[model samples]
Target: MLRFQDWQENQREVFFPDTVAFKWQMIETFIDGEEYDRSHVITESKWLAEHVKQGEIGAQEEYKHYKFNFSGNGQIEVISNGFTVKM
Candidate 1:
């Protein structure tokens, strides 16, 4: 999951990026290690592009950065072809 802020002081609550960038990169920093309370996504990912250029991933498929931030927990990041949310 990504680090998503349910509520910001001056900005509207953002659940995800306005536009999906389709990229993924692992982040290794967190203020605290605890349970995850939110998630977010970023499109037009640069990480995916780098991997494509390095031949680490295929160019035929599209991937997006999936961030699962620990709400109260290391932020885990990964690349996904696609995702769906079921409330």
Candidate 2:
């Protein structure tokens, strides 16, 4: 199993830099096998890029940073300020 920190580092060094270089309007996530909407949470691609560059695998809003948990089975759990969304 890969640790979250290690995954974060890999994201920062490779995945984000190579894949997430475009602008986005929203981010979707899943938690406990259920989808959750978070379109209102993140609206700027620059902000998201900044976090990604900073070795973060999640989003941020209102000065709070959300974290993410990546499952090896092509799934990701987004831990937001109020809820967890897995995708």
Candidate 3:
């Protein structure tokens, strides 16, 4: 998962590295009350040309699947779309 400070923060265009073999995008949807909810989905742009290439960090399916380290208190919550998704 990607860490976004706010729903709007995820709305801009992004890219996978030249090495990755897929496409992905992050988006947000506004539901009932006031907040917004965000989601990331893999968009098909390319697939790794070779099976062995998949293991390299550069060969992940999509840019979004790349890992990033997050550090914080054990309880973290996202407030959005008038709902909260706890992590």
Better of 1 and 2 by lDDT: 1
lDDT of 1 by residue, 27-87 (tens): 4443343335455554565666777778766788656666666443335556666554422
Which predicted model would earn the best TM-score? Answer: 1
Identify the runs in model 2 with alpha carbons over 4 angstroms from their true place. Answer: 1-39, 58-87
lDDT of 2 by residue, 1-87 (tens): 112334335422212212222232235444354324222333333455576667654433333223333333233322233433222
Q: How accurate locally is residue 87 in candidate 2, as Cα lDDT from 0 to 100?
A: 22
| Backbone clash count, each prediction separately | 18, 6, 2
With candidate 3 superimposed using the best TM-score fit, by how many Å does residue 32's alpha carbon deviate from the native? 29
Winner of 1 and 3 under TM-score: 1
Q: RMSD in Å for candidate 3, one decimal?
A: 13.6
Cα TM-score of candidate 2: 0.20
TM-score per prediction, in order, is 0.45, 0.20, 0.20
Off by over 4 Å in 3: 1-6, 23-50, 53-87
lDDT of each: 0.51, 0.34, 0.29
